[model samples]
Target chain A: MITFSKQQLKIPKLQRPVYLVTAGQSKFDRAFPDKRTEELCIDSFTMAAQLLEISPAELKTYIHSCYYGHFADHFGDQLLGESVIHDRLGLDPLGNIGVKTGGATGGSTIWEGMKAVASGYSDCVLVMGWERMDEVPTDEGNFLISCAADKDWESPLGHIYTGYYAVMAQRYWQIFGKSEDSFRRTLAEISVKHHGYARFNPYAQAPMDITVDDVLNSPVVAYPLRALDCCLMSVGAACTILCDEDTAVKLTKNSKNKPLRLWTSAGTHTLRPADRMDMDIPLLPNETADQYKDLGERFPGGDRYPGFTGFLAARVAAHYAYGMAGITDPTEDLDVVELHDAFTISDVQTYEDIGIRPYGEGRTYVESGDCYHTNPNTGQPGKLPSNISGGLIGCMHSVGATGIMQTFEIASHIWNRWEEFHGDENIWNKFNRQKPKDWTNLQVVGAKRGMAISHAGVGSHVTSTILMDPDHLINKDA
Target chain B: MSMFGQVFVKNNQYKLKGDFHHMTPNMPIRNADDEWKLLGVTNPRAMTYMHSYGGEAVFFESLSQGKLMASRCDNSDCNITGTIYMPFRIHCPDCLAKNSVFDLTDIAKKSATIHTFMECQRSGAFNLLDKPIKFINIEFDGVATILMSYLVVGTPKFGMKVVPIFKTTGPTYTILDLAWVEEGTKEEQLPEGFSF
Candidate 1:
C-alpha cells in the first residue's frame, strides 16, 4: 500500500559534480583493548584527513554533512565520536545522518553519502562505518545480528544467521545439483585466495597462509559450510569523504593532490524472504533490469536471469553496480572487484550473481582461476580478481563494518594504493600514477570506465558503479 | 424451560401462609400410611411445603467427621442412582420422599482418584500458586467439587492419586483452608490437629 511515485522517488539534482576524494581504514582485529567505538571512528576519520593532507578543521568547513554507519556496541552514543573528533580537531558540520541497516549498515551509509552528494543537498559529506562487536560476548553479538531478521517467524524457529545461509545452500543444491564436494572446493579456493591476498594487507585481522585443503578439512559449523568458509568476527572502522568536482580541484590545488570522482551508485531491496519466489521467475527491477538492461539485452541469451548465492543480499547489489557502470562485458571491462564474503558459499554465489559466470557455472570460473588472485589455467591472469584484500574471511566481518571495508578495498585498489603495504610493487606500479609518494598516485589506471559492487550481509542489497576518467582525475569530467 | 415453585416449611406449618394457608395436626406422623393419609386429606387450595437443611450439620452429626461424600437413591428399582456430593450430606434428595432413609459415611476418605489436570502460567491472588501454577482435579475419598487445587509435585502425570491436606490459615472454617494435595498413603495421614 505504501509506495513512492517516480517524481517523489527522484532525489534532488546536485548542481555540483561529486568525487570520492579520499578513503581510509583502521587495522582489522578481533578486539581492540581500551578502544571505544568513537575512538575507532576518529581513527578512521583522522587517517582519511591525513591522506587528503588536510586538518580536520579545514576539512570540516568543506563537509556540508556527515553520515555514520555502525551496529553492535555504542550505537546510541555514535555522536560522541563525531563530537570528540570535532572537538579535538576543531571541526563543525551543517548536518549529520545515521543509518542502521543491520549488517549492511556500512554499504547503506556509502549509498546515503553518495545520494547526499548526487542530490546537491551537500557539496561534500563525510561517511564512516565502524563496529565494536567484540566488546560483547559472541552469543550476545550474534543475538544482536539475528535481531535484523523477522523475530517472530525466524528467530523463534531457532534460525541463526548461519541457518539462513544454510537454507540458501540447500536451495542451490536442490536446483543446480551442485554437490557439497564442489561447493567445498570452491569455498576452500576462495578462502585461500583471500587469505593469500590478506598476507599483503597490513590491516587484515586473520591474515594467514591457508590452503584449499585447510578450508575443506576445517570443522563444519553448518552442513556444507566449514569453519574456514565463515568470515572472521572483526572489530574495525572505515571512512571516506565525498566532494563535488569543482571543490575537489580547489581542494586538490590547495593541497596539491588528485581525487576519486563520484561514479553512479544504485541500491535496491527485494522481497525479504527471497526463497518465496519461483526459481525460474525474474526478480523485478533487479540489478539486471534496474541497472544493466542494455547489457542484459546484449548477452546472447537476451536478458537471462542471473542466479546468485542466495545467502547474503550482496550478489544482487553487485549486479546492479555492473549495470549502472554500463559494463557490457565484465570479463573485458572490470579490472578489480570486492564482495562481502561473509561465508564461503557467499563468494561462490557472488561469482554467479555478478555475471562473472553463467547461471550454475560459478564453480567453473573459480576452477579456471579467472576469479582468483593467480590464474593457474590460462597462465594469462585472472580477470575479476575478487576479495583480494582477504575479504571478510581474513578481514573479519563486524556486521556493520564489512560493507564499507569492501568499498574501501575497491577504492584503494582502483586508486593503486594497495602496494604501499602488500602485493608486487611493479605490478601495482602499472596502475599507480607517476607521483609515487603523492596521494593522487593512488588513482586507477586506464580505468576510464570503472565499477565497484558491494552487497550488505543483511537484506539491503546495494551496487555502486564508479566511472572515473583519468583526464578528469583533477577536475569534473562532465 | 421447566416452571417450578418452592414453598418453605418450618415445623409442621407452611411458611407461605398469606393467601394460601394450610393447617396441620401437631402430632407427628409415625408411619408411611399416616403420612400418606395426611398428604391426601390436604385441601386443594392449600400451599405445599418442602424442608431444606444444611448438609454440613447432618454430615457432622451423623458421620462425626469432615468427609468427601456422594448421594444415592434409596428406592428399590430406581435406575437414576449415585451422584457425588461435596462437604458430605445425608439422604438422597431424589428418593427422599419415596424411601425416606439416608446413609451418611466417609467411604471416599479411604481412597482417592485423579480426574484430570492442566498446566497454566497465569498467577495472582486468584491463583492458588503465587507463581506459574498448575491445577489438578482429584476425586478425593468422599468429597465433591473434585478437591481442585494446585499440584505441588515437580512433574504431574495422569492417573496419579494425591491425598488432600488442609491448612488452617486465613478463615479456617472456609473451604480456603484446603491447600494442595500431596502423594501419600492413608496410614501416613492424621486426624485434624486441633478440634474445630
Candidate 2:
C-alpha cells in the first residue's frame, strides 16, 4: 500500500524572495478610432520600464518569463513583440505566456507571474495587460462581453452583460426589499467618490464630478443599473515588474528606491448557471450559495449574505492569501486596498465578501462613509480605504487589463508613488495629513501590509494579491 | 430561402449533447459552485479559455444576424436564461421552450428588442466604427433562438424590434448577412423576392 507522508501532504512554500518592485500603466480611454492593441501594450510597457528606471534591454535580461493579458487577435504578433523587445535588448527569456481570461485577463496574468515566482520556477517575471476597444465597433464589444455568459441559455435570450447583472440586481431587490432609489444612491456615492479620485489620476478615462441625482437620472441600461452605475469599456494597459528578494535588494540598493514585497497570492471560482441547481436555496447558514437559486429564495442570510455577485471566488482567494501572509484582521492589518469595481454594486459586494462587513451591511459601510479615503459618518477615521485610485469605474476597464490595473494601483499606493507621477495631491492629503515629498519620508503608516482583490465580470474569475513592506519580510533573519 | 434556413447555413453548426453529466437538484452530490471553485483554483487556465470562448461567440452571433434573439425557457419559470453559457440546459431560457415551435417567417418584418443588448467595439473581424459595434438582443415573433445581432442605428431602446436586412453577397449566407436594420417604424411586409 502506498501512503503519503505528512511532509509530502504539505504544499511547498515559495522558494524565491519575490518582490513586486515596480508597476506602471497607460492612460485609459474609450477605445479610440485609431488605436491598436499593440500600440496600447507598447505604451504600457514603455511606462512600466520608465517607472523602474530600467531600459527595455535591462528588463529583458532579468525577465525569466513573460505573460500577456489580452482578449484580442494578433496573438502571434503580440508574442513576437515581446520577443522582439527581448532580442533588441539582448536578453533571452526562457518562457513566454499569452493567457486570456476575458475581463480578468490582467489580474489573471499577474497571478500567473506571482505563481511562477512562488513556485521557484523563475526569479523575475514581467506581466503585461492591454486592450484596444476602439479598434472594434460598439456592437462587437457588446458581443464580446455577452459571450462571457451562457451562450445557449442566456445568449439565446438576448442577455447582454448589463441585463445579466440587472437580473441579479433585481433578484437582490426582491429579497432585500431595497428600493431602486437605495441602489441608485449607493451606486452614485461609489461613482462620485471614484470620479473625485480620478480627477487626480491623469491616466483615468472618464473623470467627472456628478451628483447622486446624475446617477439616478442616467439612462437606464437595464432597470436598476443606470449608465453611470456601470463601468466604461475603454482601452488601456498595465504592467508590473516582480523579482525575488535578493535581486530586489541588489536592484534597490543600486537604485534610489525601496521595493514592495509580495506577501501572497490566491485565486478561486464557483458554479456556473447549469450547476446552480445543485446549490442550496435560501442559502442555509454555513451553506454557500452558487450563481443560481429560486427567485423566491434569491436573498439568503439577508444582512449576512451580501447581494453582490462574484464575491465567493474573491473571498476564497483572499482567505488563502491572508492565511499565507499571517494576516488575521484585513480591515485593521492592511493599510490600503483596491478592488475590481466593474460596477458600483461590485464594490459593495466585495466589501462583504472580503469579510469587511457582515453580508447585507456592505451598504452601511459605504453609506456610513467609512470605506472612503475621507470618512464622513465617523469623524474618527476609517480603518480601510478601498478603490481610492478611482477603481474600474473611474479608471476604465480594458477587459484583461482591469484586474492588473487594480493590483498596480494597490501596489503604487502602498509604495507611495502615485502622487509623484500623477501630481495628484488629493490621495496624499486625504490619507496622509502631511504629504511626504519623497518615498522615504512617506511614513510606513499604521500597517506594514496591504491587500488587493480582483474579479472578472462574467462572474467566474477571482484573485487576490497581498503586498508587504520589504522591511517586514518575516524570513529576513534567514 | 427562408430566414430560418439561411441562419442555419450561415452560422457555424455544431451539435451539443444533453448526455453530458449535469448537476441536478436530485443528485445532491456536488454543486456547480463547488465544481467552479475547484476548477477556478486547480484549472484557472481552463476557466480563462472558457470565458474567452464565451466572448468569441458574441461576435460570431452578431456578424451572422442583423438582429438579436434569445432562446425561450422550456422549464418551470418561463424566465429568460441569464448567465448559463452554451451546451448546458436547465429548462426555460426565455418564457419556457415547451411545445413552442419557432418560425423565422416574420423575422425580417419584426421590430428589434433592446432590453437585452450592448454596444461592443472589440473582437472578431469587423472594425467599421471607432468604437465597438452596437450588439443587440432582438426577439422576433417566430424564432426560438433570441438572435444576437448588430444594430446599424446609433442608440437602441427597449421593445424596439427593427427589421433585419441581409447583405447581397457573402461566402456564408448566414443570418449575419442580414447586415443592417430598418429603423423608425417596423416594416409591415417583407421586401421583394423575400418569402416567409
Candidate 3:
C-alpha cells in the first residue's frame, strides 16, 4: 500500500495547466533514405501544425521557442545539431534548445517545453525529436549506440547495449526464482501481446501475429533476449505543441475534444550503481512545504538507502509522478500507460516499476493476461491497457523521437483521434501479412487519464509525465 | 496519406556494406569524454571489434602486474565510507568533490563475490570466443564499485567467491587482460605449485 500521509501528500496547485493541443509523427519503419532528418522534422512539425489549422507562417509567428531531441549526432548527416536543422525549416530565429539524454531525449525535450510554457517563458513551445539510424550500418550503429553507456568503464569491456539489458533480465529472473522455460515464455508472451497491438497501430514499425513458440524459436541476440524481443531500429520523427490552457481553448474552439492537463513532468539520473540502489522517490514538482517537511521526517537525508540499484530511478520517477497526480493506485487509477519497452523483458519489468504489480511479480502479471485489453482471467476489460500503441517493442525505436511519440499516443487517446491516423490497408498488408484481430474498435473506450514514461537505460535516466482529460481535472461537478 | 506513408514505396533503402568496413585497427578518435583517449580495435580486414580503455590506463597496467587496484577519495569529507571505486572515478559522484591531483589507488583484495552474471548465447564486439561470453559482475569486498569482467573458467553462482586471474602473456592492458576464476579453484591450484 502507498504510505504517504494525506498531510504529507501535497502537490503545488498550478495557476493554469499546460495543454497538449495536438501532436503528429512520421510513419515508423525501417530506413527512409530518401528523406533527410530535416525533412522528417518538417513532416512532424507541419503535420502537427496542420492538425490545428495553423499555417507554417502562423506556426512560426506563434511558437516562441523550440526544443529538438536527437541521439548520436554521428548517426545522421547533420553536423552541428538538430536545432540548426530546425532553423533550416524556415521558422523564426527564436533560439533552439537541443536535448540529448539517450533514449529519454524526446521525453526530456517535451518536459523542457512543457516547463517553458507553464512558466510563461513562452506562450507556445514546439518540441520535435527525430533520428536517422539507417545512414550507418548495423556494426557502426551498434558502436554509436554503445557510446550512450559509461564509455571509460562499461563500453570498453565489450558491453553491448543489448547484452547489458539481457544481463538485467537474467538477474530479474534469478531474483524471482522463475524457471528458465517459464521465464522465456513470459518474455515471449509480452512480445506476442505487443505485436498483436502493433498490428493496429498506424505508426508501428513491426506488426505481426507471432506466437510464444515463434518468439522462443527466434534467434537469441543476447542470451535470453531474442531478436523478436528487442525493439526494431528504425528511422522516424515525432512532434508536439504545448500551450497554456487559455491558448489551447482559443486554438481548439472548433474541435469537439478538450485539451489534456499536463499534470507533471520530471526526470532523474545517476551514473553510479552504488548510489542508485535505493528506490526512493525523486524530487517531484508541486510538493508543498509541509510535504517536504514530512518527507524529511520519513526519509531523512544521509540515512537514505544507498544499496538500491540504478533501475530504481524509473520506479521512483513513476511513483513520484503518480503521487503528484493524486493517484494512489496506478493499476486502478490509470486508464492507459505508455512506457519505454526497449526489450520485452523491459516491458514486463516496467509494469512492476510503474506500480501496476508489486516487484518480481511482473512475470505473473503477464501470464495472468492482465496486461491485455481483454483479460483472459475474468473475461472483463483490462484494468490498465499499457503500451496500447505497441510501445517501443512494436513501434519503431528511433532513439531520439520515441518519447514524444509515446506522449502523442496518450494525447491521441484522450482526444479520441485514433481513426484519423490509422495506417493505410495496403501498407499494413505489405509489412504485416495477417490482419489484426480487430482495428475497427481498437481504442481504449473512455480513457480520461493516462501516463507516458520514458527511460535512457537500466534506470540511469528517466522521465515520467501524466496527462489527464481537462474535463476530469477542470470540471469538478461532472 | 500520412506524411511518412506517402513516401513508403520510393523512400525505403537498405545498404549492404557497413560504414565500419573501412575502419583500420588503430584509427584513433578521442572518446566523447575528452578525459579519455580511444583507439579503434576493428581490423581493416577482420570484421571483429573491441575498445581500448585509454583514460584508465593505470588500472590495466596494475592488472598486468597481478595487482587489483581501485581509486579511493583522499578527502575524508567527500565520502562517507572512504570506499574505493573499481573503475576509478575522477571525482566523487556523490559529493562532486574534485579528486586531488594524485588520486589514491588502493590495492583491491584478491577475493570478491559474484554479484551478478549472464551467460550469453552469442558474443558481441570482441569476436566469438571459444565459449559463450560469461559476463560476470564481481563485487570486491569493501569496494563501493562493482567490476564487470568475464569468467574464463568456472560457472558463476549468485554469491560464489571468485579471484582475479591476469593474462600472463600478450596482455592487451585492457579489461581483456583480466578474468575471474572460482575461489575454490584458486585455492586448489595455489597449494599444488608452492611448497611450504
Best by DockQ, which number? 3
Error of 2 at B72 (Å): 20
lDDT of 2 by residue, A1-478 (tens): 1122455333235655568877777667884434445556666666666666777667666778887677654322243454543343344546776767666677778878877887777788888777766644565566556666655434423335765566445444434435446755776789888876776666777767778888778876665667787888788778887888776766555443467777445444432322222122222122255433333354442432222333556655665666566666667667778877877766777776676664555677787776776576766445677776777888678776777787777766666665565665553353232332332221224445667776765456777777877776434531
Identify the candidate with maximal lDDT. 3
Can you list each candidate's DockQ? 0.01, 0.04, 0.17
Top TM-score model: 3
How many clashing residue pairs appear in each of the predictions shown? 14, 66, 6
Tell me the deviation in Å of residue A60 in model 2.
2.2
Off by over 4 Å in 1: A1-16, A73-90, A254-257, A264-275, A279-323, A421-450, A465-467, A470-478, B1-196
**Candidate 3 C-alpha lDDT tens digits along A389-453:** 88888987897899899888888777777655564566456444444657754567788888888
Candidates sorted on lDDT, descending: 3, 2, 1
* Model 1 chain A: ten consecutive residues of lowest lDDT: A433-442
True interface contacts retained by model 2? 0.02
